[model samples]
Structure formats: structure tokens, C-alpha cells
Target: MASRFTRLTTVVPQLARGYAAPAKTVKVPVTLFGLNGRYATALYSAAARQNALDAVEKDLKALDALVVKDKGVQAFLENPTINRKVKLDGINALLSKAGKPSEVTKNLFETLSENGRLDQTTKVISSFAELMSAHRNELSLVITSTKELDKATLNKIAESLQKSGLSEGKKLLVSNKVKADILGGLLVEIGDKSIDLTVSTRLAKLNKLVTDSI
Candidate 1:
């Protein structure tokens, strides 16, 4: 299933593969919804068709890593006063560190930087990754807890969730976050569905139930 999903981006001729009868056809890029998603999706589709998805993915990952490593790169990408050429060179240099970036990747970055949307680069990468994961029928879950959970606890939660029907036949990806304001317990986000077990939410519900019972 996973292998077939990864191959979703691959175009195998139906007739050649004996999967379908021969017919005239046209090619269209797969697009993601949302603005940043659209751009990222277009870039991914282009790279996939050109067989440069791996290279582009690596370049994006490297850039994303830099944004988290050196504070300067993040600030620079988001700073509008730096000028397009400067931002392009900055990203280009980073890409160089990872070896040559695909021309399509370079062009997309340049376009976004020139339009003062470089800040969206991180989101674009994230969106692209998510798009790919989704192509593989994978969904990521963000778990917000008041305190950081140890590996044992996290794996426990993941294990339990895995047994549940939250994703059915689909894949489940988990991300953990710490938020002091939650007071206690955890909140989980699985796609658009969120399960709030935080004390804050429980209290609110209890309060509502009490008031309504009054």
C-alpha cells in the first residue's frame, strides 16, 4: 500500500502497463488547495514529472533545517528590506550546500522571494511534505500537552491510538507539543478533528453542563 502510494506521483503508462486500453490524453499538474499549498503543489508536481522530487525534497529539507539552525536565515527570509536578489542568493547559497537545487525549485524560490512571499517558503515545504504524505494516505497528529512527555509515554499514546480506529486503514503521524497554559492533560489534532482533553477544555465543558443544569 505504501509503495503504491509513493508511486502515486509516478506516471506509468496505463497501456504499456496493460492496465488500460490505448487512448489520446493530456497531462495536468496535481494542485493543492490554499495559496501556499497551491504554489508548493505546483512545484512538487513539476519536480515529480521531471523526476527531481527527491532532489527538491532534499533542498527544501536542508533549507528548513537552516531556518531552525541559524536564526539569521529565518530572519533574513522574512525580512522584506533585503531585496529579491539578496534573498535569492541567500537561498541559492544554502541550496548549494546541499548540492545543486533543481531549476524548478530555484525558480519557485526566486518567484516567492521576489514577490515578498519568502516567509511562505517554510510553509511551502511543510505543505509539500504534507501533500506527499497525504498522497500516501498518511495523516499527522499534533499532541499538545502541558508538560513534555517522555518517549515511553509518547510511544504509549501512539500505540494506543494506533489500535483505535482514528485513521482506519490510513497512516497516522504524531507530533508532540508542550503548552503550559493547558494546565493539564493533552490535546490532539488529527487532521481537522481535534480531541481536547486539557483541563481547560474539561472545565469549560463542566461549567457549561453545570450552568445548563441550573
Candidate 2:
């Protein structure tokens, strides 16, 4: 286990070298924690130095979609029985088939494979995306409703959020998710904060108030 961790530590610098001449220091746009965060931070730093942040992000988004759509790819990454070398080769082949992915992106998957962390691939990609979004000054906004929202409605909500200072200067990447359990109204999530306006939540609050009174 110690050796595996050591390999993981060393791979980051080695991958960094494969990119452009190392910057004196690369600033991570956001703070992230945990193993996935560490890997994502390292990849972000390397990509930032290489000026390939967009390319690496594009590669990761494509890979993430592929994993979602391809059960075989999902199985390959999650399979613990497969040896590291075979996983490495499989990653290489998969990247090859994906058409020219950035070297930084390739290095990320290769390092993950070598360190037997392929099962964390999806999480790492998500972490990397968070970093990229931060880098681009983008904020995630999710609106939960009982039905899918039209694009115009989403845009209007985003604009309102921005005007209301909830979004402020950040660019909002808005998405809507349907949840019948919400009952009615919207559950808006802007970055880490949530404004719960759902009828279910209001009803629950009213019930709690009555219970306390009783």
C-alpha cells in the first residue's frame, strides 16, 4: 500500500514534465479535498501549465459520457480482477480509439491505471470538471422541479439569480432535474448553497411547527 501511494505521488511530477516547461507555480482555482481532489488538482496544475486545460477538459467530458453509455467501459474500469498492466494497455487502446486526447489527459488515466485507481475514474473526472469550472469562473446552478424546464425558463431563472446577487459575476451553468417528490415550486441549488422552495419542504416545516406547538 505504501509503495502504491509512493507511485501515485511520483507519477504527478512525471506527468507534469510531459507537458510544457513547468511553471514556477501553478495556482489551483479552487480548493478540493480527498484522493480524487488530489489527482484532479495535479492534473489541473499540469494542464494549466501546458495551456491545454480546455483540451483536457474536453477529453474528460467525452470519456465521462462514454463511461455512462458503454457498460463494457464501465466494467473495464471497475473490474478488480484485471491486472494493472492489462488495465494500462486497455486505457491506452481506449484513448487511441478516442482520437487524439491531450497528453495530460492520457497521463491521468495511465497514472490511475498504474496505481490501481481506475475505479475512481468517474469521481476524478468530476473533480477535474469542478476545477475547470472554477478556472473558468463558472458556477453550477441546478433547479429541481416536478417536470423538465424549458430552456427559456432556465435562462430566465439564471438571469434572475445573477441580478439578485446569488450568481453575481459568475457565469451560471444551469440545469434542471425533475423530481416528483418536490410536489411543486423549485429547489434551487447554486454551487454549495440550496434554497428549498418546494411545497413538500414547506409542508414539512408547517408539520414540524404544529408538532412543536402540540
Candidate 3:
């Protein structure tokens, strides 16, 4: 692990080395750009190379949960006022207290801190998860409605989506989000595709059509 970390650190100074996608079709297919994307891609490649992908995924998911569940932690990651050394110390302590974090994950935290990229930690985690999902051939289904969905409603929506072949042989992961501004109806997003049936969108279309016809 130390050797691998050394290699990563040595390679990072080259700037263009770690951003390359793995030379396999089954790896993450999406082209990630920008600093967050490059960091996520590098992490994905390193985890894959070390055969610690599953452990890294679990570690990241756990940390992601902490970020979501604790506002203080989220603020700590996003806090621009915090100095790099202070933030790095806090993050190392947090990860040590949490479940076992893989060497790859720990190295990633260190790299982010060393480069003053801690503010983008949340985005990096999210992008890494996206890469993981693609590698696992998982499909994400997000339903947006005016109100929070009950379990039964969510189940029904999942069942309906499954029957409609939305999964496409990939595992289906469903989530619901509430957006009161939509007023009514559902807005469904599957991967890169979105179906917007919200009342607001329909009303806007109607208004546009009526004005155009006039």
C-alpha cells in the first residue's frame, strides 16, 4: 500500500497521467472532465488496480452518508475559511473514527488536502460513485414529485419502471425527491434521460403553444 501510494504521489506531478481511463471496456465509460472528474477517475483507476474497488466503494459510501447526515461534517468539507492543515487533520480523525477506510481512500483524502481541493470533496465522492455505478452496470432511477413518496408508492413506481424495461438488464436503484415547485405530476430521471411531466412544464408548453397560435 505504501509503495502504491508513493507511485500515485510521484505520478500526480505529471498532471496528465492519472486522468486516463482504464484500458478496458467494462470500466467506467463516461468521460470525466475537470478537476473533480480527474480526481474521481484517478481514484477509480487506483482502486481497480489494487483490487480494492469494493472496499473503497463501501468506505466512500459510508463517508458520503456521514456528509449527508451531519451538517457539521458537510460544512467542514465545504468550509472555505478552514485552513488546509486544520481540515486535513479533522478529516483524518473523522475517517479514523468511522469504519475502516481503505488506503486508497485515505490517500485520496491526503491528496485533496495537499492540493487544497478539499472543498470539492463532496463532488469527488459523488463522481466516484457515478463511476462505480457505471462499472457495476447499475441504473439510477430518480422520481421527483411535489410530496415525499410513501414506501408503497415508491415500490409501485419501481415495479412499474421494472416492467417497462427501464432497467435494461442493469440493477435498478430507485430514489424519490420532493420538489414542491413542480406543483403536481411526476418528473422521472433515468441515467442521462429525463421525462418531465410536471404541471409547471405542461402549463408552460400550453402557454407557449397558445401564444404561438395567436
TM-score of each: 0.76, 0.91, 0.79
Number of the top candidate by lDDT? 2
lDDT of 1 by residue, 11-91 (tens): 222101222334333233334667666666666656655556777788888888988899888888888687867888888
**Residues 88-190, candidate 2, lDDT per residue (tens digit)?**
7876676666689998888787678767898898899999999998988999999999999999999998999988778858999998999999899999999
- How does each model score on lDDT? 0.71, 0.84, 0.77
Pairing residues by index, what is the TM-score of model 3?
A: 0.79
Model 2, position 180, has a per-residue lDDT of 100
The whole-model C-alpha lDDT of candidate 2 against the native structure comes to 0.84
Best by TM-score: 2
Backbone clash numbers for all candidates listed: 0, 0, 0
The candidate, 1 or 3, that scores higher on TM-score is 3
| Residue 34, model 3: Cα distance from true site in angstroms | 1.9
Residue 125 Cα positional deviation in candidate 2, in Å, after optimal superposition: 0.6
Please list the residue runs of candidate 2 whose C-alpha ends up more than 4 Å from where it truly belongs after superposition.
1-3, 6-11, 19-22
Q: What is the C-alpha RMSD of each candidate to the true structure, in Å?
A: 8.8, 2.3, 5.3
Pairs that collide in candidate 3 are none
